[model samples]
Target: MKSLYAATCALALALPAAAAELETYLEFEKAMPPGNLAIGPDGRMFMSVHEFYGPELRVVEVMPDGSTKPYPTEDWARAPQDDADGLNGVLGLRADRDGILWMLDGQGENQTGRIVGWDTKTETLHAIHYIGAPVARPTSFLNDLAVDRDHGAIYISDTGDGQNSAIIVVDLETGRARRVLEGSQYTIPEDTPMVIDGREITLGGNPAKIGINPITVDPTNTWVYFAPMTASAMYRIPTAALLDESLSDADLEAQVERYGDKPISDGSTVDTGGNVYITAMTDNALGVTKPDGSYEVLFQSDDELPWPDGFSIGADGYVYATINELHRSPALNNGEDASKGIYKIVRFKSLADAVSGR
Candidate 1:
């Protein structure tokens, strides 16, 4: 028998240096681009197509044989491009151990936010709730989310779409959402210009402030970890403290701990052993952090992983992510859809274990 730490070490040694070459898992037509990756318990992979604009297929499940079908239903994905209800579509997804597919949705036009849960096992729409008003303001990006099943709560990060940032906590059982750490350093973005492939990333002719993009919870569900796209360090807070709305803003801020210095990351996930896997935006690779808060490069990024946007651990222990090719989009490239290549979904050997609180 082997210990979890020893297994992780052996798996790391099995990976190649300078980053192992990644294989293309799936490709999408330009009309329907990729958003995020979510692997379910049975090895079924789900992806959220770009939100809003009422995409033909907003949420599609990637079959093991290399085909895709609209998840739940196509009608369920008809996100109103004009702002009737922003919650109609999904931009992020996570399949929990309970066999439920949780989706993170936002109205790009109005910055409205919503979360929906679909019971994959029973094939039923489980729950749906909207994030409105104070918690989710007009500028909220509602970028990503992570579930804490222990207390029946879900934490959402508002990227501020460049203007601000905050974490929105919702009680799944009660349908109550609370805004925490608003405008704090943890949620604020430096908007540092990112240079990938010698091309500076610019959106709307200015540096993009994609704050609080990635959020993940640890195995015991004790801490909820998070980071901004333009970031210096990843932060974590006690899950119990985050759920207590009675805590003052100052008190909650005090609970935040600088887990460690990290690179600009778009997505992050944690294995059961407490190893944190994050997208290495600077070197275009996969980076991991130990439980002690030490960081190291796992695999260098390449191919369809140009912009690794979302991450999830598969049932087989592989880490999966999506190649958004975001920097080339017309929305950021002055209306010129300059995607260097085709969009795709990719995965790599995480070597650790499945995500926490799953």
Candidate 2:
């Protein structure tokens, strides 16, 4: 269902003029594209270099002048050959209120998923949790994650095809993990074609179909929201119900709520007023879903936001997003990378104040 604001915005997109333009925060000229970003309380910007393109570095810190450097250390940014503990492939990252940066490593083709938390305040390791086997299957592409500090847990979206897709719950206190809602209707991708510019993106010669990719926790940590990259609706479940190991699959599914409708999206974040900001990838725009299930387009770009991927709200009350042109990647472009020069990290004002790292 289209909200009233969305209905009006849909009509606005029909006009030739631009709706809103994003402010350029950082630009990547010769570097690999960024996957996700997290802004610290002190204003430090950290981003994960997308692993889909086989980047040399896993993570980097965006300096004041837009230059990039290995985050924390060169060694940590570049994993030693055959070293599983090193930062292998990070995409989803967030900053806790305590200024601790949490990075989620899907481990690339290795499939050794792990979560690494770095204490920016003290320049130390806060925690490291490994996810494997029963919880992370061979086909699991651990995409994005949400840190529920209030519940002492982390919820990850396992976009393992559309059949085995599930939301993984990891206990922050004990590092135990369990896969819930595996292959449920809520977690699986809809039979929607991911078309960009009139051409459907293909992965391995077939139409790219991703399931339950964008995931985020609300400002109050009350609910974990997520959706399939090919689905049109956002779904959420209470943090309490997710943390309750006693709940069966059906019980967990019963608590799940279809929050609102959204376009094909990649990443998301929320503000203090329960507004969820999501990257409207198909439209090359940014949008938000309000507390009352109303969704509105905040901005739509003409040429700038080509495949806006991840979102992070900074302490300055701006929403930062990565534009990587993923549909042009080799995997999606029929074995030929069609991305042009310069990826970007852009920021726009949020409708409401937001938690620094989400």
Candidate 3:
């Protein structure tokens, strides 16, 4: 039997540049994909698919040669009996130090939202936390998640449309979860309407509204930064404030500071220097916010970089993102899905240099 580490080592090689002008990587064939990306500690790339009805999860491994291989499994869907109608899709994925793959289950159509962990060593699945019933709206769409392994906690964004929108903090050790920020103020709706390709659009065919969607935490477990999928303002709060039960709601709210006025950002990640890399969907560019509260466009691709969904800062100093054409589909406010591909921007320095001023 081959180990996951061995499998990864056997495939390590230099991937040929896909494009000369831009750093082109392999494009995994996907259909209507959602939150689908996870980078292993060994520098291997993995992505999943979110097809509407069937074949919910399609896992793919990107080799160093810029080639791709798909995991032979259509059984990634694990729907509980309670939410039989909901669809099982892998949204946010994180491989902890133990090689366990933690996934955020965004039960799309069927509406059952939960978090599960896949132990590759044991080849088993375990439900770490379940979100449903009285605490949160059953239809609440749990989007992305960021884990603080040092403190054993996970912060998730509940981007519930109309029904509910809030940030959920889960205690990994205790299996307890709480809804910290809720309603329009904290989970405020976007003021400027979402205009894609000269037309207004909304995700899931509903009216375009602001809700907290994608989130990313700093490497030191100090801050968790997030923004609404359609909002222009970026907000964040200290992990200490969020994890502390003694902090009053007003105190926690006061700690939530506006990071900056950003474009339509779907996903974000911070480097070691506390610089936040945000996928600005509206401007079709990748924006970077330094530690000094200043933001700038790191890289800009023509309209081809549409609807950038997730962010993964590679050890090699390249920032990767998934460009899902969510606004293009009619179900998402009648937008068009063009230039949908995974993209990476490489810094002219090593990961350490990118973090520290070389």
Residue 30's lDDT within candidate 2 is 46
Candidate 3: which pairs clash? 15-64, 85-110, 86-110, 87-110, 189-210, 190-210, 205-331, 328-335, 328-336
Report the error of model 1 at residue 205, Å: 2.8
lDDT by residue (72-122, candidate 2, tens digit) is 678788775665336878889988887889999785465478899999888
TM-score of each: 0.87, 0.90, 0.80
Mark the 10 consecutive residues where model 3 has the least summed lDDT: 11-20
Estimate the TM-score for candidate 1. Answer: 0.87
Please estimate how well model 3 matches the true structure, expressed as its whole-model Cα lDDT: 0.65
User: Which one is best on TM-score?
Assistant: 2
lDDT string for model 3 (244-336, tens) is 999877888899988876777778887775667777777776676656576766567655566666777676666677766556543564444
Candidates ranked, most accurate by TM-score first: 2, 1, 3
Candidate 1 C-alpha lDDT tens digits along 57-151: 77887787767787866556555466442236677688887888899877555455689898988888899888988777777777888988878
Best prediction by lDDT: 2
